[model samples]
Target: MMMRSKKIKLLSLAILSIGLSQNALAEDHWKLFLKNAYIDRDFDNDAVKDTGSWSQAISLFYDSKFQDTPIDQLQIGLDANVQYAVRLSNDKHAADSVLPFDAQSQKQASDYAKFGGAVKLKYKENVLKVGEIWSDSPVANIDASRQLVGTYLGGTLSSTVNDHLSLELGVLSKYSARNDDQFRKLSYTQNGNKIQSDGMSYIDLKYRVNDQLKAAYSFAHLENIFNKHYVGLEHNYALNADTQLNSKVRYFNVQDTGSIAAIDSQNIGVIETVKYKNHTVAAGVQKIVGDAFPALDGYIPELYFVNWNVTGFFKKNEQTYHFIYGYNFKDYVPGLNALVKYSYGEKIKLADGIENNESELNLIGAYNFQHDYLKGMGLQYLFAKYDTKYGNDFDENRFFVTYTKKF
Candidate 1:
């Protein structure tokens, strides 16, 4: 514990110095985010007690791009971030019970700090980054659903093949979860036991068919656990100057590998959206085949599916329908928007032969200050209600305040 704390302090100091330095030679950018989240959970089954939590988080990021480098067409970049989160509510017992913490221990997770940094080398249209990485892709993504963000330790390379084609590859070995202060080997849980993996590697390609169509494919292997393949397509059509239509389709296939137990599943999703000036509406459907969807150890967010809501709706044999409505109030109040989303799932089959159903509703509102005094400040609020037949029900509220500055 002491060693971890010391490392955090050292990293935090280093990042803070870089962010606050006014005379830095490189072109630097900085951003700070603040968030508060609260949850109220209930259970239909009495054995599982109801719990709740309220937490606060602060995050700071610094990025520096060196303008002058010895190598022509080669750019050097440095990126770093530090995050701190703590339980702010007086209900310590409840907070400890429900907070995002190590599965093995909860007492030591009341408050924690973490830091990560990465070095980037960009030459022409190719970029290479090594160290702590924050990524967002179809197969692998960092989770920002909580007060803090999850990150991976790895190296990634991306290249632009042409004007309409690109490729990306990465190998990751360790990660820190949203609430964790230290990194650990990648792993997943099975029968209440943690099964560690050697590492993970992935490659993806994207192609633009035309001005209105795009396609992507990705494949990932979690050393000795499972192999996954994903394909996606997107299209856009303009109905008129003030109206547009967008459509998307995505598919995923997972199969077990090596000595691990069978981890097989398939997912299919389709979505359509229509936008008319300031109003937007969307509808989607998704299905899960074979076994339940398997996730990495650190509660990673699976953002590739259309039915990703508060519950994720990833149960085996589950079929879900999703709806969304959004309105942009920019004309009335610049930088303001609101959205409502709902998801319902049925034919969910777990180990039990019986089928179950689940549903979720979400409401979100956000506003960014457009005035000169607070141009970079923003505020957001979210409310979610998740009800399930085979699991606990949750009612959650989250508030966030953010500010960004560049120098």
Candidate 2:
């Protein structure tokens, strides 16, 4: 604890020094974001009781360019965040608490902070960076759904090989979860057991076949655990001036590798969406083969299946169907929009050979204030109902008020 505190202080001092040295310049390159959120979750299963919390978070980001310096193509980036959450209610089930509980203290955790930065070198159309980073690759990604976003520590290189093709490669050595203040080795969890790995590596490629068609492929490996491959195709078609149609086909294959052979799965999905003026509608189907989709311990993988909501909807032998409806109220009420989604999964085969089903309904609404005083402020509300045939049923509600400012 003492060592961690010292490191935090040192990082703070370094940031302060940088700001003071370039006071005037830094102002133009810095941004600040603030958010206040309240989340409530209720479970029907007594084993996992209800939980609620109110949280506040602030994030700072800085980007500096070496314009006329010797390293003119180099840039420095810094990001840091502080978050505190207070428990509003619990069902007195510390053993099964869904809140942010500290196992050692047997109580809820209230404070979290992280600091990280990166150095970037730009060469022509290619860039290389090393340090803390976030990715949105289908095979490996960071979850930004919570109050804080996840981060990985390592190096990444992105190259624009040609007008039609682009490539990205990276190696991650450590990970900090959305709620964690410290980084740790990457790991996989199954049945409450965690298997730690040295790191993860990945390669991603994208090609533009035409103006409206694109294809992507990604390969990822979690050291000593599993290898994953993702292939996807996307297409867009303009029906008319005010109408557009989009479609996607995505597939994934996973296999156990190295000494720790513990994973085997395949996932595939297809989706079609059409947007006409203010209304949007979509539908999709997805399936899981062999086993369940495995995530990196507590981290959420970028499962881009159409049926993926709060859950991946990928259990052993599960087949899911999904639909969505959305409306843009900008014509009637500026800066307002809402969407509702539903997903149903059936034929989920548990280890005991019992077949079950699960479903989820989600609704989300948001409004961004257009007034000058609240120009950068937004309000959002989200509600979800998750039900299963033989598992815990739950409902979730989240509300957030956010503001972003650049100095």
Candidate 3:
């Protein structure tokens, strides 16, 4: 306990010293962004009833950079986020616990309303950063598709080489989960047991061959737990002025390590889409072989594109087919758009010959105000239905309104 307290004190002092020391030499650099959201979620025919209330949330992001010696090569900065959320006054469960900017209001959630920040240092194209920040990568990422996103605490070194290749090396120690206010160790779960990970690291590489083609490979490892490797290719082809095709193929390999080895698995996916005028149609297929998807704790919304509304259906021996249709009505009604999707999965054969099958249908519509005063204001609605032979069938509805301003 004493050591922990000392470490905390040291960290606080370091933050203060860096902030104050650079304040004198750092030049003018600061930014502020504000976003507000009102969200309502209702679930039908589930173990949990409809949450009695809605949620209103406001979030702010502020960052500043201080340069040394009037040059851009060496610099320091601090960034922080503040999130506030409250249940709807009318919600019967208005006093129910809260969650992060993540999903499912009726479920277990947390309060992300507190303050957190990180300090960053940059030199040229290489950046050495240490702090807590939002993630959007395939692994150790924050899924902000919902209202509150989680954050990561660690340090990383990233560099762009020769304008075509990018590289990153990082170590992550903790993650603030979307449904919990407390930051926890980066760990994985097996059976029903939580295995505390010693530490986690990643090596990510991406290369761009040309404007229309690119490939990437990333590897993440947790001591004595497991390792995840990914390889991907993306291409875009323009058929003409009004038509185009986009395609992607990706693969993941998960393997066990050290003492508590669980499962080893491989997964592959392919997707293709055609865009014509204001309409887009897409088809995709995914297959999982070997073992079930080796999902890490706190990891939600499958890191892969196979993820759907309810689940990715990424069980052992699971195969899924996906289809989607979307339209942009910008020309018809300015910033209006709509999308519908369906995903079907089968062949999740169990050892007893029981095949668990599932399917999902989702619909979404949104309108963004483009006028001057309400330019950044938007309204969105989403509905999803999940049907499964694996049980747990239910439907969900979500309504959201949002406004954001940057200064």
Candidate 4:
């Protein structure tokens, strides 16, 4: 049975790291922190006929703490992570190719790579975690846009019951949709060699109703026959001091519970099949300048709403809209940045048949160099255009350079 569930998740992470090192040796207060990151990407598409590929990644993180703990009343911790990826080009396009395939003319070098680890146990507002993490739910996150590293084994619980509420719950296993291995269920096939059943489950909520409003909600249950729901709302105001007025709205719903007869026989010969309810809506607005903007500092930068692999651009009843404006040059170039964005969406078919609509435009420019010979260097440029009524129209361009250091 999956090797006794991997020896009971490695004996429960070695008994939670020996009970957090015996509670930091009976309260001598210990702490540790380490982080590392690296990434690379390249892609292109002319309606997928080949000419796109490149990937690389490395990551590591570990955190530990035990600040005076007896049975919880303040601090206690353990967080761990380890990740790796290498697939530097081998070109074999078209397996749902949205561009990027040619890893050395199909001889496929690198041959995919992955390893994962996770452990979390905290006590000052509860937290208990387990192996193979990384599923920032909103319908499956952790797709750092390629370079592999997608994980999920199971067990998660987070809590914060005061000062504006928070809660999260999870259960996972059966995820290998391209990498970050570990699967004994959750099936999806198409060249990773067809296998099925990865029933998913999730619950999340966040609320903070002061200091400019906030809200979030979610529920998921895929593989017990798909049922998903999410709702979000955010608002911030300060239309002065360099302008600020952020707003956000989101909603999504999906349903189907005929108990999977092969997902009702592949939606019955798909022509964009419908009969299992779907609805999605998104809203966005961003404008900021000076004194801030490191990817807009923390929320709502609208690259299709906080990357759950580019958050659904209209695909339920279908509707989407986004707009962005940015400029930061306090002294002409301290971390130079500029941006322009526009998006439009449409896709409707309430029990009919064919008709797909989509429109998009994006342009971005970035530069962040704190000159010490390029401190944590980063430079980027991107352009995108897509138009569709039924077919034929595409344009995408991207170039990025990134570097980091931490030890």
How close is each model in CA RMSD to the real structure?
A: 2.6, 3.0, 5.8, 23.8
Task: Name the top TM-score candidate.
Answer: 1
Best by lDDT: 1
Please report the TM-score between candidate 4 and the true structure.
0.28
Kindly report which residue stretches of model 1 are placed more than 4 angstroms away from their true locations once superposed. 1-12, 19-22, 42-47, 94-108
Cα lDDT for residue 384, model 4? 67
User: How displaced is residue 256 in candidate 4, in Å?
Assistant: 48
Q: How many steric clashes does model 3 contain?
A: 9
Candidate 3 displacement at residue 340 in angstroms: 0.5
Tens-place lDDT per residue, model 2, 171-240, is 9999888767778898887777778889889999999999999999999988888899999999999989
TM-score of each candidate structure, all chains considered together? 0.91, 0.91, 0.85, 0.28
Residue pairs in clash, model 1: none
Model 4 misplaced regions, further than 4 Å: 1-51, 54-109, 122-125, 128-142, 150-157, 162-164, 167-205, 208-283, 295-407
Q: Which should have the higher TM-score, number 2 or number 3?
A: 2
